[model samples]
Target: MVWKPDWVASKDILRRMGWSVVETTMMNSNPPEIEVPLGNFVKMNILFWNCRGALNVDFKRRIFEMVINHHPSIMVITETRVGGDRAARIIEDLPFDGSIVTETIGYAGSLWLLWKTDDVDVMLLSSFEQEIHATVKVHNSDPIWLISTIYARPRLSERRILWDSLKAVAQLHNLPWLMLGDFNEVLSSEDKFGGNQVSLNRTLQFKECSDVCNMLDLGFTGSKYTWTNRRPIFDLILERIDRYFANPSWRILFPEAAMTHLPRTCSNHCPILVELLGSTPPGPNKPFCFHTMWLLHPGFPNIVQEAWTEDGDLQGAILEFVSKAKHWNYNVFGNLFAKKKRVLARINGAQKSLASRPSEFLLTLEKQLIEEYFFNFTPGRGILGTEVKIECSYVWRP
Candidate 1:
């Protein structure tokens, strides 16, 4: 039989899980500003994805989620399989301000650069069968970057042609240059696992290509391997075919840049993120908010009554109320935000545990915590959004 639970039961379940629904806050009397939006400026996130032509309905949604979560300034995609009329639609769905795409020849391979729609002035220098070369200047920052993305031809002879052409392209401009994509080759043996040993001759060719281009290996931080054959463990193959390489000038421009291989949940190849951090300027202070959720507790009224006794005037009374409200919250509530953090941590632990042993009880607990997390994601919504219609009822004594 399926189990159903109401909010009351869910609350009891949460309490049993060690996180009570009636959480309180130990707030500051001076009302410290909310420390949100840790980063002041929007740093550039460069993402390269070899999607391998799986542009299902969820494909676009997944892309949107990645974009929203990481806010990449420049996004590069390969093997999109979308062509002609459909390519435009795909670009439209991207959160980035604009994009440039390479031609798709019968759904074989395609390359494109997507950038923030505004303050992005990029000129397409050249486009080829295997690559697209462009110069990008964000907000006239003077540190212009020449970017080239390649989806190399699978054949060895054809790859030689691509390497030679790329060598010529790299020397075309003296600016900071970044080269990235699915080269379909490995530079080192460590790049492959569960596969036949990579040939010395193949690695030599790839190394020689990098030498000719003066490209620095912007090594990755996440999964050691970026591509998998999707076969069973015994017959499985994994290799780091996708890579990000840049010239010395590029490193000089963004010294703290890093590339991380994000987990591959739905694709053969994992998407790599190249983070180019920028100077973060100071942001303005956040305004104070009055949380009506506090009022739900019986002590809230007592604290307000004690703090609201008229001072010299209305302004003084309000000042006193604000001061005591903060003090009372600190003394009485015992840190509400900390409670949220603990609840989220418990939820994470429950999720990991459920993976090993699935149970209806754990599922219900996870669902409850998820709801709790969302509520905390947007604090004090009880008094914020119009969804909460507040009504004041008057009791008449006759």
Candidate 2:
């Protein structure tokens, strides 16, 4: 497909908004790779989404925004619907620089990769004698081999083919390997949701596959199943087919890695978000802070107090006080700079109103402002609120 000017503009806008857009490249060519300086730590996040069909333009745009917002380093997509010439064009449109491997027919394909940075290399290995597989190498770290989506038919023979394909990749890579995506085979009775009986033969086959590959199953603890067949027939419904298995080496590389289910949109299977760490210092966890006490100074108290007496606006008086407390530079605080400026602007406006207010009222307003600011800056008990104070150099996509 021809690259439209509008599409290029849109892609640029998306990148500015923090989406990694793929550059144009020849079909079937490896994504470009650049040497990443050796670092103490490197963190990479990979997002896996099936995309259902992605044929709808609106849905495709939403997917683009979602990836941009999350800002993963590498994205593995399954079930990409673009076919033949359209497939090449779709890959061209992706915000990241990467490659695509689609099924003979558009929507049935197992896997595709969209890589953002030049620090990583990708090699598409032989298509599974019956499945899909690829090898990815990250500069300055051990290589990671990936196997794509695997679908199993109801017949045991077909499931055997899927298992055999997995073993083949494990044997070929010989290094750290991560086999993820839809496995289509439930490993145990616990893997399914209620009312469905898992087949003993299927469970045995899955265990055998794991044993032969020397894999560790990262099972779902919260959600019992990954797939749901609405049919009433017991034989027709099976679940928990989507999973990630890795060898000890890969496990050490990502000790905290686990699957998180994304909200179900157009697809029956939920997308998985995976985080990989390579000796990288964890990024800052706490939101930026602007100290209110820093704004209160002996010399500035009189000016702010005078403004409070003239302007009755309490928030404005506090902002006026903070503006004069210039010792606290917003630029030093990184993410908190914008918020500080906004608060300062609002306070300046309030100072005019406070200039007419009584001294007592102004004092109370200042105290209240300090209290509110402190409360807002306090760390809370949650993922976003947790404080991360570690100091280390690391490279991350975000």
Candidate 3:
């Protein structure tokens, strides 16, 4: 096998620090070193994950890191395996304003629906054998959506009860609804790989269940196979049993919303991040800036030359140049500067806040923000007089 000393020592430390065999698999490889654009989004972040279990100390730490990175407004975790007794121990530790957890079934499964109360108003609607149903009023606005985080019963015989109960619940509620979880069944043959052929009847049953509930597949980004048996080579079995489905009505509410499968490390199932674009609230206005494309437009230099000659004093000429630039920029090309200034302003504000009153919470948030800003920095190439590290580098989309 591999005998890298650095890797061995790292694994040894994690094992000593209470990490399980599976959780350390994260250190074995980094996420594919390629950039994929998941269009920018904010507000109403929902992360659905089947953590297998959150009992291990190292896994719990990883969960905290995921929360801070995604900044999800609502998070639903399934197969948590946290019993009623242990629920009290973990609920308060989660970085959310409120949470609802269904009673665990001996050792098989559990469900937790956590939300940032500041971002949404969540009310419990029903709690069945394997699901926790709730209504979330995002931003406390109209047209609330029903959300259910379910842990499907493992056996074929018990799945009907789970399906029927959910269908009955859906029939009772007319609101737009979204359901996502590990149903323990695949949608079709294409959803499974290297697993003794998934039976046709099984796929039909799942499709019928979803059809009865009027649920349709929402598209996603990232690895298609979401759940794996974690076995090596020939013994491994993979499936797309974990997914998100929503009715047409829900689509109408958040048309621009998208789901992306984030990098998976500590869990067998990848975490799905939902960007509810329709729910994103407004932010402060962007400042003005010059666009390089303006140079290509006809008569651009003439306008600048006229403005510069009209001024009597050197200071007046400089002021004239800026004012004329703003007018032309706004009327023609639009402002292009957005990244660096925003990053610097946030870094400054976070520092001042920490200085005024130091706290662990502020410190952690600031650290993550700083890391993200530097990670996004694009080194400028053209234009000799530009700042050493400019953020307004133009990228050709085509």
- Candidate 3 residue pairs that clash: none
Candidate 3 local lDDT, residue 106? 87
Expressed as tens digits, the lDDT of each residue in 127-191 for candidate 2 is 53234455566666653444454444446787788787666445432345676766667777756
What would you estimate as the lDDT of candidate 2?
Answer: 0.51
Q: Residue 301 in model 3: shift from native, Å? A: 54
Task: Score each candidate by Cα lDDT.
Answer: 0.66, 0.51, 0.66
Tens-digit per-residue lDDT, 1-398, candidate 1: 11122334434443443322111111213222322111123267788899887376446655764664455778888988776667887788667667788888776887777888575666666677788777777674655567888899788997888888877654433456899999999998877766688989988988998998899998876667777675644555778899999987777677778887765544678888887873244357322324445666578777667655544555555556666766876686555545654765676565444434446575567567756655554335422110121211221111
Residues 5-61, candidate 3, lDDT per residue (tens digit)? 344554565455343432233345733332312232335778899988878654555
The global Cα lDDT (0 to 1) of model 1 is 0.66
RMSD of each: 20.9, 18.4, 21.4
Q: lDDT of model 3 at residue 55?
A: 86
| Clashes per candidate, residues 3 or more apart or on different chains | 5, 24, 0
Model 3 is weakest, by summed lDDT over 10 consecutive residues, at: 382-391
lDDT of 1 at 227: 79
Ranking of predictions according to TM-score? 1, 3, 2
Model 3, stretches more than 4 Å misplaced? 1-42, 278-398
Task: Report how far residue 148 has shifted in candidate 3, in Å.
Answer: 1.4
TM-score of each: 0.61, 0.55, 0.60
Model 1 alpha-carbon miss at residue 307, Å: 27
